[model samples]
Target: MIVLHNVQKKLGMRPVLRHIHMEVKKGECLSIVGPNGAGKTTLLKVCACIHQIDAGSMYWNGQDVYKQLTEYKRNLGWISHHHFLYENFTPVENLRFYSELYGVKNCEETIKRWLKIVDLYVFKDIPVRTFSKGMKQRLSLARALLHEPSILLLDEPFTGLDQDGVQLLFHLLQQEKEKQTAIMMVTHDFSHIEKISNKVIFLHKGEIAAESVQTEEKHIKEMYKTLVDER
Candidate 1:
């Protein structure tokens, strides 16, 4: 589980996140939604430890992340807008490099399995530079899930996906959920992943304007519209 207590962050002189508080338990998915510049992405970065909070604390399974940065990071997987891939490398090569960095033994079989899971097995040896946007996104996802981290931080993962790609993503997410991986996703479109989400927070101006527990999808949608329309 991960928890944030009154977290705050600033970009230069401007405050980006203010008094943010949230929790994500294993097997749970939390969706963050808001208008542009609402700091949704920043919040995810903070949770991923990519951005440090200027104030407050973030904890992983009861331990303060700052105190055990390396260990904490080992349990995290993050995906943002950028593919973060080596364009010149093939899908297999990319995964191989990551697997090596992660010190994952017997990665040969694991890499193959993930490539097949993402439906990119046939193109595993092709350079990423030649793959389409949706294909690149799929490969990125495969990289993220390579280590089977305990927590996932995602930012707009569905942006460039086609119908089949979306289904593949959903399928992988479901598998991760079953494996008890905690997930926090930032998205404007929640229809695809809503069923798997256990919580939704409507953020506004770096604060949570509205929140809903699982099973309150209707309430979440209503509040999302109200919040976005009001802004």
Candidate 2:
């Protein structure tokens, strides 16, 4: 449902992403993996229509994303590497407020359901800033699902999680895939790629180095090792 055509981006004289042509099929889960400064985040922002491309274009379901950014964005959800919650507000407050903002129906029911899904129902009245990174991450997942978006963009989603938290996230991805939400995730390695992503694209020096379809070759960790060795 998302497409990028010969896309290029730069920050002043430094190029971040170049000639990035990619397509995310409806209901597919694709992961972008690379070393630091490999332009993973930059590429995602361009595809999400949150950053301007210096060259080429991006589209969502045949609609030019850059052209109708505001309208196109309503169907998209974002989870960044940084904390996305209000420090002073309780979890209950944040979820309730966002539900109203998104004009969600059965808002309270949805919020409660998501909170339970993320295992944050007990801490509903606690301030987010006081929670652990894993707790915050769980709440963030609930927030992303708040609007029932069709496309999801996640950046460094596992940054602050332990093994159990990571496993929980994997289950969440499976759930989203079942619901046919197109998910684009930026990950650090291949160890977790197989369980979480159906496709893996490696970004190198602002360009797409390679793409692997899960198909029968679900050895994500092995392939990722090969990619790293080849360079």
Candidate 3:
């Protein structure tokens, strides 16, 4: 459902991403693991169309991304380090607000379902800023999933998540995969790929250095170490 063709990106005069090519099909979860300054985030932003790719092209599903920005974006769910919810608003309130913005039809049911799925039902009435890191992360996941976009792009999704929180969120992602949601995750940790991802994309030196199907070995950590040391 996602394709990149000879994509290149630069920050001022410094190249951050170079001629990257990758694809993820429906129901596939692709994990991206790379070192700091390795262009992992840049690659995600380029795919998400949050940043303009300097050269080559990107296609979502079949249409060129730049040609149909609104339609293409409507099909994506992006979760990042930044929180889009209002801190002063309650979890339910924040979700309701977004539901309206997205013009979601079943707003109330969607809100309840996500809160319960994230186990934030009891805290639904509480303001978001008062929440701990883990709670806020859960709420962020809820907000991203409300419209049920076909593709999910998550950057550092496990940040601030406690052990149990991490497990819960992964379980929800598994459900999304079962329902044929395409996913591309940018993460430093490899633990969840065995369960969630169908393929692994490893970025090194601002390019796609390794690509492999998931195996019993979540090999990115070890392989990245060896590759970096050799360089």
Q: Which stretches of candidate 1 lie over 4 Å from their true place?
A: 214-218, 229-231
The TM-score measured for candidate 3 stands at: 0.95
* Candidate 2 regions with alpha-carbon error over 4 angstroms: 215-231
Clashing pairs in 1: none
Local distance difference test, per candidate? 0.88, 0.83, 0.86
- Among these predictions, the greatest lDDT belongs to 1
Models 1 onward score TM values of: 0.96, 0.92, 0.95
Question: lDDT order of candidates, best first?
Answer: 1, 3, 2
Give the Cα-based TM-score of candidate 2 against the true structure: 0.92
Cα RMSD, each candidate = 1.4, 2.0, 1.4
User: What overall lDDT, based on C-alpha atoms, would model 2 receive against the true structure?
Assistant: 0.83
Q: Supply candidate 2's per-residue lDDT for 199.
A: 84
- 111-199 in candidate 3: lDDT tens per residue? 99999988899999999989998888889999998998898999988888898888987888898899899899988667766767788
- Alpha carbon deviation, residue 68, candidate 3 (Å): 1.6
- Which 10 successive residues of model 3 have the least lDDT summed? 214-223
